[model samples]
Target: MSQLIAPHGGHLVDLLVPEAERDALKHEAAGLPGWDLSPRQLCDLELLMTGAFSPLQGFLGRADYESVCRDLRLADGQLWPMPITLDVSSEFADKVAGAPRIALRDPEGVTLAVLEIADRWQPDREAEAQAVFGTTDRLHAGVSWLLDKAGPVYLGGRIRGLTLPPHYDFRHLRLTPREVRAQFDKRGWRRVVAFQTRNPMHRAHLELTFRAAQIAEANLLIHPSVGMTKPGDIDHYTRVRCYEKLIAHYPEQTSMLSLLHLAMRMGGPREALWHAIIRKNHGCSHFIVGRDHAGPGNGADGQPFYGPYEAQELVALHQQELGIQMVPFQEMLYVQERAQYAPADEIRPGETVLNISGTELRRRLHEGLDIPEWFTYPEVVSELRRTHPARHKQGFTVFFTGLSGAGKSTLANALMVRLLELGTRPVTLLDGDVVRKHLSSELGFSREHRNLNVQRIGFVASEITKNGGIAICAPIAPYAEARRQVREMIAQYGLFVETHIATPLEVCEERDRKGLYALARAGKLKEFTGISDPYETPESPELRIDTSEMNPDEAVQRIVLKLESLGLIRPRD
Candidate 1:
């Protein structure tokens, strides 16, 4: 008679096969058609198999998908806010058509489970975006991923798990719902409040979460989402180190830490409700809903996708039905005069309050500025610094894009030489013609192939930037979408400075160093940018150099100044 809140839908669903059966299933899976899971899909499958998603046995069929999207409920009326789908390429869908089961393998080709296909169909993604995220804007990270990254068809089936996905890091903290429940039972703890986060925990977060537990009269679970969160978020490795340091400051026997491999949709209100259900399944009796929980920042119109308090309100409405209490997160502020932290609602009108925004903290980190002791622990700050060193010490990419013969390569070469002169970090030049001959020799001048070529350069540049090296890229990226994608990729690891060589097309043709313009004029070359194809000028580049107005030496100086201004390089006295 253990008395933790019953798992969502009354019983925890364990999809893992018995040890005796695993060997047979694994053997059979090798002969079946296999689909390698993407990172997000792997997260979903892990939870579904381990009962973190207790009511879900497998990916949703069309009926359940439609039901959840429309009303935030399954076809049978179970409250499930997010759709758990297994998206596949059209080729895979066609290859496995009419198959009773398909093998689901990890990226390393290890068989993890067998999916008994009950349904397969192409979903109307536009409708899904509107219903789940309340927006059709691609600027919304969730909507952007759904439209651009997800596959063409979705597979729905019951999963017969042979084993859980392997996680080499944080093995001790990755607990299944059953394991978490057993821990609660072992500790004689009944009421537990779960705090969901994807960011590093600071002093303000510590106070807020402690107050939340006190209000709920329960133990606290510092559960963080380690799966796919918003892009540009602090990497999980650094954030986990911060969490580990912060956890030691909690009152003994009052809190514990666990990791959740959840692929968050950043669905705001709906996502809040979804989080509550997940905590409920994890044996928590209370769940914290913060301001704009899981929100994906501003929309394309520059308005918030969801109101600040919308998530709290939605979770409060369903707490009773969810069998969990909603613990609204109170904004914590440091009162300088009182020398203590206080909730925003309780602080006196005259009290001098202080708080550091995430943006401000990042700025301080970038400039190697001081972070006050009152804002965060020294241990946590040390972890952040270890990963994010000051901008001048970190790696970065300088990407030059423009029309042919716009002096992009010359500028890049000069910049590389100047950087190498400083002897600070290794510099690699990825010139367009050089990369084409070495990296993308098979690619063509078609729009798709051109975008792929630029993406390949971006990938290499990002790797260089990640390894504390400078990468100078010179390419005629032309398309805005491709450039945007490249910027996003490199930005994840280090600074990405886009320098637009805004030389006029007439000047570029006149230079004609490679005779490309002459061939395009004679129609010998098709899909030539600035001739037959379009070259979308960058709306906002870090530096706009008109080579026609200045020599390559002067253009390189302008780029060096731009980098210095950004604190990526030291300014000369």
Candidate 2:
């Protein structure tokens, strides 16, 4: 046990000697003696300054230290040292859910630059920040300068750049077993159990959590992350409040709720292991590790960050290493018959409760529609509605994925026109060709080149979505992995409906409409999808449109349905 939280060999023990030696140790550990903090230690320190600020400041800083300031900028008038939380060093994730961004805008609100801070600098801090933020100023120095926009430049982690939503997501959200246990104990409640998630709270989440608590005879801790969660994540503060509101539905004596500010590394099993350990520290007696705990996902160009069940399996393997007992959960699907969440296998073949998603729910809330109690309790929906306000707040984007010459552009324009007619929200269509022209002007059409092109488009689309504008993207996005990756990313800001234009290869070829197919056949085109190379259909598109089967008007209507299903639009009056 001493080793578990033990101070290390030579200096860690020596540093504990007395206050006279503390300052010397602090300087030496930072400089000559070289006591590099583990990724976890660094992360904890960051949280000390952010989440546990009051307590930590009292301990670490002089009594005169008032509070901490978040954003610090540079000479260029940009928020220079974009904040770095622990998520990067630990999970080494590419994303942090609900992390707020420092919009690099002038006084006019027109964006000139945007900053996104990832996990700790991979190599030396200087070179890495230079590469990521495109500047070499140490973040600490930038912080000392104070940000340009001034006035609490939005704390929390970063999901997207200036192009993202207004609120920082719960990018480093965490809830440990120890914390849960503490909260529970304070309330005189024992048998604490945590509900895990990578998404905002929805009816399904509610149902499952309720069931888990009831079955285990434990008080529920609606624990969710603001870490590297699902891309289109609800802001952690909002979700935390949402859970708080939902807690009222539970027996007051049987439920407790709190927040966890932890980073996501997107390292699947390791992520689950990390989660369990954190929960143990939080004093939770039991933690529910579901199908995929802390699964941030991987794009088409990369392998899945981890396997399905990999997280659960890892938790099982490390059960002995943890202080918390594990509560293994099955994939809970919405059961239509009961109009509640149930284990996927428990559902009758015919039951259906308007199967939908938190993603869809957010869309609906944005559009200002009444979410049925069958889907989520009125209190929960109200919380979401208040936070998201959908079409009114900065809206999100529409991204289309299909083959070249598959009419993605035509359909995107069609959707854009319709969205424009709906009024209010601004729309930006980032066609693959146009985006390539902007981002990859110097590059050619190679596989690696194409991947970069779509990635750039995805980033922009995410920003548009974050800003609450309708960003429509028509990228051939041939790789299934790449399309999925883009979808996950855009999800951070808004809805990402993978509209698979399942226009048969034959149809696309015949349309060679651009004559590109013929060129590919004749070797005039290289890396052309469905030609010398290939195109992978989406594993399960949110909505599959057959441009070959339906008229453009019909396609648009189908799209409207898709948007409605996703809660992006209210039913046409």
Candidate 3:
């Protein structure tokens, strides 16, 4: 083993306040303004304090931020690829604008660090998005978060860490950058190759990583991010369990597993570079850069934001400066006849090949289809099945939205009764009027208030689905955007069936079960849908029923049939 790779900026920077001085720092922070750090910010602080992001002493100042956004370099010309700034709301910015120092606290109000406020400003976030991410479309997850979730102003300064955020689970598996470097040194692993992944490793991943390590003649570091990832990805706990199962296949002492607390930006090429820098800080001499590494998938136009090989090319361009070798991930296919994985290009002519895509894997899991052992370890498949049961066994939501007299509640009641008779799963009915009386008693009829009410219903439905129960919600959720938001929220846990009761306004007014239509017409109900407020028709709905054409029973039967076809339910014998 030779000398270990140096930190990104020529020296490791540890910002954790020494144990002897932590008490004093706490005393000093007591009088300062405090910010309860978000989960993403907590990840950033941990990396900074542990020297994982060594070149970064703290959050980016205005100068460094502007430089990084304009050019993928720090103000001092170091090859730093991403901007790391503390974002705060306008109100919070005002509160801490002139403060000399501010405390960074966890959600439980424990101080984690103290920031010496050096610069604060409102950035041109649109420009920053374009320069860094190549697009400002909301379809891109990172850009959507930047524009919607991030605060209005940026705060930057150096930080004196008081403590690392507490992690109750995976305590033994969590290793700080310094701890990993120490372990590598003790094991005489100077040449280490690190693999960064957010998904569960199938045989494809295992073969790719093994080949990269062999090529580099380096020890393997299975560093997977435990922080936020793509919204629909499998949870970290299940992923970690899968990793643990696959680790037995590797030669002992030649490979190790550690969790990385990184809230990925999904910045594609730039993210790949950032990963390399961080891996180098963790004493890795080689980092694997795969096709579309860290990419957030296609945008609204159905095209990828970057070329497939773009990440590999960018990492190769800066490999010399980065001091980390770039390991290009080759396309590997499972050879059916050979019963092994081989590089796609190197396969002999006419050899049968089988490939499993992420989408197909999810479909197989949902439909209780076979996931061949050649694709992944049987133990890993079993763990995944424990968490992700077949759709017929999982909970789901049936959201019915329509005009006031559109028979949504009537059809919902019928559906609820039918589902209960099946006795297959627990069923909860959340009628719009009933929920308004209990859950949203004091809410008004403003757009914001209506959205909030729908969000509340979505939250409850998501919880029910997560616990393997059916949540049937019938609400006059007039806005399509609000419905889309709820769908996204519930999709994280289980299936969301959006049923549109597209009864015509004339027919609904004629039925007038609630007489709310008369009040809306008389101006008594100001913001009523189909009168004063508009109902944005759903462009796509799982099932659309018109009460005029069919009775509530018939509509319920149609919905049940759709669910059966989707593998969400089994037809009664």
Candidate 4:
């Protein structure tokens, strides 16, 4: 295991930051809206400061030195790929394995450090090569020595694990009018519209987007987010493929495609402005704004952070300022008979309508129910089916609802291993403890905070399920209403199975892993669930296996059966 360095002296293999530049780095990051780097991130920043990864350095140096400055217009330079970040745990593994290089730095024609591409790492040779880097007199002793001795020490900072937004060359950002106009001239279309969504393409959404294009008398650019979108949202690979399928429906030689690898800040109004700014950068004259653009979560009483029109209105407010036009519409509700998208303003009263949400659409697809072309095109459905074959590939919310000491996490890990072997579909397990550690780091264990805590996990799990993946959640999810809210969110994805591991309070109290239950009984703890807070187990869950009565294996077996019976898990593919 790669050791986590505490606050102390630096080790080798470390990215060293001069004290002079540390404040400057933090200041630059702080200048960005809604950005905060953690302590470990500060250490990582040294890599950028030390010239290990100067994403914009090359663009700034040679390009500017050799050529006279162009009128800082759109022709300033060509576009380049956005900066990239590798997940910490994933990168740690790659470093230990000595993964093959996907890209490398060259200084004065001399090779420097190389990096492995996150998605494509052929582990065999690298894994063998990594042996010399570990401890003892092993071949990897040099690497081990560097890691132990040269790594930077944590000096008490924030977000020690989070990655940073990339610093890219501004010169290589915008799409020149010359290029875009050239394409427009080829296609015989003057005006162009862009459709941007961090979602899988649904019929209602397509109707809205395509209608915007048609209304603008322009071709469509189905641009999707391929970066750090909402956590638990469909991964870009599936969403991108889904877009490819739907784009096939557009008239040939008219529409185009692109991907935006931008991370979401979860800032509502500011997010709209940012989206408009980016769309402008991509040579889009106009953008489609939906209600609550990029809303991260709800507010005080389960209401969304902003009203539906608030995001759109924010764009409308800044439309001229940002140099982009906005097409804002109410949330599109599907009309079956018309079988296409229509403005909510145009729909007549008394039309028999099914208010199918992205959630319901996901539910139907996950349960193996056939979807009509009216709701979603055959091509898109085919793509979804490829990932989640209706009946055979059901996503799951493996909820572990028990007291703290009831061994929920242990069983969860074992279940994860078993499901990994069955690996026909992706699985994400959200343990309460783990979620608390990673996501709700700022919150404490207050009752209100507990709700917020589970809400975040539910949101993530819901995203996973929406994108055709399994979610295994194990929280007390104590309040029935809170649990219901989570269910409603995951319901958007269709495969929401709540497995309540009902162990008796006495059993849980006796096995208090944290001794909190014991303290609660001894009057040392207050507001503890099952003692003061009361946990209402699912009265009507899909599966209610009593772990106190049945063994873990038997409980898991029963849970699997419930899955099979519900058409979530099926005969071997």
Candidate 5:
């Protein structure tokens, strides 16, 4: 008697082996070639096994991969908007070549599944990126990961799950597709409308979702992605706590909260269609499709990649085939006169509307400014504040990059002493020579080695910033691209201040305290920066100091002023 939509491809495709067969599968997998799945791959496999990614029994083989990329459909004409492929290094591909099966394990060495190999091939990644994401530009996060981080080869086959990946936290709230459908059945909820979100909900979200469900005459499913989202998104732990608090405000028996482990691609319009199919698999009769659903904010050009209404339009185009009704997200605003949320289009002509954008909300949290009760719940704000303290109270990094002997070390040492004098936080100095002596004793001046050294420094600084400490790093990070990589790595947790010690190269050579520039000029040093090798200057740094014209104290004072202006540190009394 339920009117819920059927799973994609007509059945819930659960590949998890029955209890009777798991023991044998595990035993057989021990002898097969093994691959430790990455975090994103593990999330994909979990959904495939649990029927959350229904119709995808395994990673796509060559034929299916090509088909999905060229068009958002399987070879058999089933609509699937995304391609799920398991990529591996060339060494693994050669080892698994012509093998009947391979074992997949987690980082802890626990065998989770076995893949019955069907096909192995190297994909034209550029083509895939263009067709699937509409661009091959590295500025897009997904495209960047695809080009730089992913492996060279892909393996595709059917998967036999021996055990589901273990999640110790929020175990009760993590429901499989079957379990959620069963819950709906138990509640006699024949009509269920699912709302997908990756961010914390405010009053506007509650109003929009409630109105959506009310219009559809269905129960509400508050499903949130707990896996990897945008790089700087709120951590799942904090977002989940916020969800737990917000759900209390909903009417009992009308709404349910469930967590999903989905590594989102931020694919914009295509992602909207994929999400609709997923909700259909979860036994929902309706799904909410909003403006900019699943969109990665902007491209490198600082323009929106997809039109604001594109996602809604794309879902509407395919909802009939997808079998899930689309409930468009209503733009709700708090009417000041009535003090209640009303659809933007339906408000009276003279009525005032109040809204809080995500940027404003973050600004309020960062500056420790008051967030109005009309915008967000007090409990939710408290949970956010616990994770994101005020900007001045939070930890940050000060990175100094310039040519060798450009007074970077002196300025960094002076700044470290000044921070230590404040006696507010732990301060650590990572000078180039000191770090080379300790951390990079084995690394040489090759481009690859230099990149590795900078990455190691970025990782250490990120940890320090994450734990509420100050890290002052001074290095001749010559390549602009490498410096950008470090900036991206550290920006996820805290502010990354790139201070360019813009002393002229001639002045740096004239100082030559270590006499390295002399050796380079005499052709004694190979691949020496600014001599034999190229040094790409930063296009725009947070602070640029001309150490040739100013002493170390003045340079440090300039940096301190920059940090204070950005609210990273308090002004000295």
Candidate 6:
């Protein structure tokens, strides 16, 4: 008999068919209707097929879904915190209705599995948000996804996996639960502790994990999520490189590193319990539950979605039932007097402690500031620097929004010329008229079409920013929501500066350079901004200029000054 603990619920559930049966299923799937899996669905499917989410045969049926949402348990009374459902668009749901089975395809159109449909329903997203994440506010990233990004309908069924998703990068470290358990048995690791993290591991994290392992007297498993985490997080490629460098610091043979392709919901306490269950299934006896584990930061009210110790408390409450012990993460601090690290509660008062927060570290990286050796390894810092270069060396986007005839194009031209004069980086100007003619020639001025056009521009701008080039965009982006979406898209790669040309409608009409306002006033043009259509003003922008009071050159100078202050450009000597 194996010395390691048994899989959750007495056995691991493997959805993949036997090797002998794969050929038959593959042939049958070709004639069936197919649903392309989204990124989150893909992650869930992988875990389901690999037995990481043991006892879950496939997507949750309506009964289990409602039970999981309301009571954090399945209809069978199993301890399942998160709901695992396959959401789909309404059109796909209708097409697949009453079908015996449907193929599940990846983005590349390769069928990975066949789902035998059992139930379908439209989820009450608001209720699910309140029950699971404790909030329905869009400021929460998970809530935003539920409300805005998720499909309208959910389909539940049993999945017959043909093959796991192909991962070309880091294949060795991506071990399934069964493979991980086999390794544990082979190494005779009786008791193992799992540390789950989505962020890059630094000195504090290293110390925390080391101490956790020592306290539990167990082998350490440094398992980080490589799938979709919170937005604006460091890319997994960079994070994995950092993890590889940090692992060498641990005692040889005491630690192992693995990657979990988990699409995190950032549900705080509930997510903590779910993680503990997952680790238990992976042959771990102890799991780390940190302060604000899986938290999605603050809400729209500027208050944290979950308390600091809520996750730890929740995990501890179900420790025995989960078949895994909860290891509470203690905040580590560097002591200047002793030149060593100590836990927060163990440190003496006024001993000159030092710590760097994630925000502070990001600021340092953004400004090319130094990150001391005590905070992280030099190799990790080098990898971070390669991805997040100094602000002046990085690409950025400057977006100007205002009413038509507000001198946006004029100011954009002047700013473009000024930036070109510096000759430090290649600059691309995407004026409203120019984009309308070339990129969005088929698009109309309808709300949907306009938003689509703006999103297309945002996509292009994001690409430019990602490639270390500057993009200057000038458009009558009257809707705040569309502009906000553009800002988010650009911000993921580099800096996004929103400049509001706050020129009044009357002043814009007085200029009337394009005769657009005249046409709108004469009722020749319909659905025109500042006439028939509303121009939702920006609540807060990086810079706001009213051309009625400022000239083009002066406005451009102010923008340049703002960029310099933001460290995107160096000041003249």
What are the TM-scores, per candidate, against the unseen true structure? Answer: 0.95, 0.49, 0.94, 0.50, 0.94, 0.95
- lDDT per residue for candidate 4 within 13-94, as digits (tens), equals 2222344655554444343222123322332343333322222221122232112122111224432212112223334444
Over 4 Å off in model 6, which ranges?
Answer: 1-10
Model 2 segments more than 4 A misplaced? 1-226, 229-233, 240-259, 263-383, 390-396, 504-515, 546-551, 571-573
User: For candidate 6, what is the TM-score?
Assistant: 0.95
For candidate 5, write residues 29-114 as lDDT tens digits.
99998999999999999998888787788999888888888879887778898989899999989987889899999999999999
Tens-digit per-residue lDDT, 467-510, candidate 6? 99999998888888899889989998999999999999998899
Q: Which window of 10 residues has the lowest lDDT sum in candidate 4?
A: 153-162
For residue 107, give model 5's deviation from the true position in Å: 2.3
Q: Write the per-residue lDDT of candidate 2 for residues 1-573, one digit (tens) a residue.
A: 010121110000011124454455334323221112332323333333232221111111111111111222222222211233321222322233333233233233433222232222222333333333233332222211222111221122222111211224443334333333445657876566777664556666667777777777777776665533433467776777677667777766776656555544344555566566555445556788777666544434454445678778756765764555777777777665665677876778767736666556655776677787766677777767766775645566666788887889888888889888888678888988887777779877777777888888988888888777888888887786677667767766666777788888888888876788888889987877888877778878778888899888899899888777766676762
Model 4, position 291: C-alpha lDDT score? 69
* Tens-place lDDT digits, model 1, residues 395-434: 9999999999898998999999999998889999999999
The lDDT, on a scale of 0 to 1, for candidate 3 is 0.90
Q: Which tens-of-lDDT digit does each residue in 410-496 have in candidate 3?
A: 888888889889999999999998999999999999999999999999999999998999999999999988998899889989989
lDDT ranking of the models: 1, 6, 3, 5, 4, 2
| Count of clashes, each model | 0, 51, 0, 16, 0, 0
TM-score-best of 1 and 3: 1
Ten contiguous residues with the weakest lDDT in model 6: 1-10
Candidate 6: residue 231 lDDT (0-100)? 87
